[model samples]
Target: MIVNSDLTMGEGVIERHEVETFLTLAEELHFGRTAATLHVSTARVSQTIRKLERRVGVPLFNRTSRHVSLTTVGRQLHHELRPAWDDLRAAVQRAIETGRGLSGALHVAFVSPAAAQLLAGVTQVFHEHAPDCEVRIREAQADQILPRIRSGEIDLGLTTLPLDDPDLTHGPVLVREARMLAVPAGHPFARRASVLTADLTRVPLVRLPGHTDIPPRQAGAPPATTAPTAGTFQEALTLVGTGQGALPAGAHARRYYARPDIAYLPISDAPALEWALVWPADRHTARVRAFVEAADTLIHGHGTTRQPPQ
Candidate 1:
């Protein structure tokens, strides 16, 4: 929570871009690099800094022919203004979240039934944290979750872990469920106590549609004999139940989507499935961060609110 007056100085409230330019250049100490980082021209950075100096009634930088450094006053201004600027930004973000109401639409998607349960609990806790914020939930096919978040169609997603990419920001592990193999109830492997990864992919594996790079081939596991294409999680499960193929899944499936025809056998050598909250890198905001924190608390902290990562 912050007050705008704390950021305002005298009658002439300084422009934001100027502050940004000053602070960025202060840290970068290179006009070209600062401009590049800010997506502005070097000339623009110079103009903005000069303007800021005039407004502050002092030289902010000691510029030589080959180099640049923050003047003593500039250093002081950077130290003092940085925190105020952060407060101002936080206040504005809070105001935006508040103006939109904790009731504003916060679209979220989930790909698995276990993730759905965790998200339901997260949604409840998030609502309690910010009653006016509304959480809109949707079912997402495995292949569609990341795309929807990247395309700005959804604010957040509950999906599998290890989605390491530059464009995505994934939160901490919400749940770690043991891995299981979904096979036709009558399959020979279904009768076994457990299946090893070395033998898990001997049969065809139903894959999430649109995901072209299937994993066993990459992970050094037994190569799947077939890669059946399916558009939805249920479709993939149904394919496995009917003997079309097998699918690796979280153990939660045995409870939420148990079927007489579908046998979920433990994968003795498989790693646990880690589900986390994920959102696009650029769209991170107060709401997204707050909701993620709430989720981390409820799911990882066992109902007690936990401090989010710095």
Candidate 2:
């Protein structure tokens, strides 16, 4: 018959290490090996098991110097504990795998140019691997993208820098792209390898209305002329095609809207424009994970030109 002991109840009676030792030994069923696994000597494993038995008021194991096996009580304990431990292990593994890569949807938002240029390849790769996952892309301005991300209206965003908010996580997806001077085919600059920014200073310049702040050059190219302003890429493109003035655009824009009448010349000396990928700090869902992975893989496969800025 088992007897209860008052000494076992007060405060510091059952040591957690003793319980852990029992479970570990039970798993291995070998004193010396269990001891080695636990980084302790067999003597210590024996002492710990004895302590646990006394505290539990039951024999947990049938033991002999040659072999150790579970007693009736030990078998009961194993039956009860095994499933719980298995569950814990499964949960931990799931968490790690989810952290690595798993099934989910990812919503992406981008500015007009980025939407047109970068998202297609990214979506294609993501869908190929995660066929069940869904991707939604929205086009908005820098100001509009962040608010939606903050409000949980979007999962990820691509935009230009100067994001000072601490609630958002952002990384450079592409470095400043050299601005290309886009003109009509008959334009003189179209025949040249590249055009100087200074050459446009006195020329009629078609500019994005609200984006006057955007730098006017390709890498270190000369400065270009500016008309008062035009809003949106479509507006700027339209004005340039009509020969109103030259428009400065990123490399992607030049290729996306390649027109028979329009010609794009590289700017010789302008500061590049920065492109970045951003997401909210607190948003973590399977879909978001899928999107981030797809974006990463797409960026990687594209080689240097498509590589995200470090």
Candidate 3:
């Protein structure tokens, strides 16, 4: 039984069920509908309504054979009680959501240099939203991203798409960079206006390991014969500089990683590199959602429009 704060019951304490029944019936109007809504039988609703009316010493609902409507007292009660109930429910929900939300350190991972740049912007936004929360931004290899997320080593990842995993969910795209070919300055294609996929066979297309398993060269093209070096960003670029092979890269590479020995050639026939935030499907938390929302404020249909190379 609950104390009747609405009505001072000196002799009769109000049962919680009575308030629920009255409010639900008041909203629903029909006894059958109220029963269905409350998952109770029609007889139970009728009995409860009768008991409540007896306690109030008045009719709460006007009933005819065809219809039922709230009485004047019931309307006023509904008006006053509805808002209170809504506010109470909202407060309870907010408390529960806050308790269940992010509380400790969140580890975020990124693969490419472009992803790191995008994540830096996102981190600023995330901090503004959650100033107390610690966000650890870590550089991760392409292959290490999803596995680390699934293993709970990382909370989020910023990586490329065509991520066909059922275990992960990808967020809004943060960048769309044009594909560029990183060629040795000594190569002929490096001087071309724009390179085509057909021109891939004309040079040794170096394969950088730890890529998302997307082929380094177009299908059926001769495999890269550039002397295989340990898979590292600088090592691959060094090979390109030595005229060992040309490498497919994002347009951002030329801007940030520009080198005197390496030339970035725009690939006219290649698709753009799309980057988005990704997280474990089962581990989607309030922090992850908030980070995605923060990213949306920056990227989704907003000011960070793609600017072609100058």
Q: What is the C-alpha lDDT of each candidate?
A: 0.78, 0.69, 0.76
- How many clashes does each candidate structure show, in the order listed? 4, 16, 0
Residue 282, model 3: lDDT of 79
The full ranking of all candidates by lDDT, starting with the best, is 1, 3, 2
Error of 1 at 135 (Å): 1.0
**TM-score of each model, in listed order:** 0.64, 0.52, 0.63
lDDT preference between candidates 2 and 3, better one: 3
Candidate 2, 171-234: lDDT as tens digits: 5464456667778678888789997667767567876633422543455655655664566777
Q: Using TM-score, rank the candidates from best to worst.
A: 1, 3, 2
**Tens-digit per-residue lDDT, 71-147, candidate 3:** 99889878987787667667766655554565566789987676787788888988897887788999987668888
Per-residue C-alpha lDDT of model 1 across residues 1-310, encoded as one tens digit per residue: 3233423555566776777888899999999999998899999999998877877788999999899998999999999999978877887886776544455779999876666777788888898878877788998877788889999899999887787679998888776667778889999998988887776558888877644223233354545676677887778888988889988777777887789998888886666666678998877777888899888778667653332211
Which candidate number would show the highest lDDT if scored against the true structure?
A: 1
Considering every candidate listed, which one attains the maximal TM-score?
1
Would you give me the overall lDDT of model 1?
A: 0.78
Worst 10 residues of 3 by lDDT: 1-10
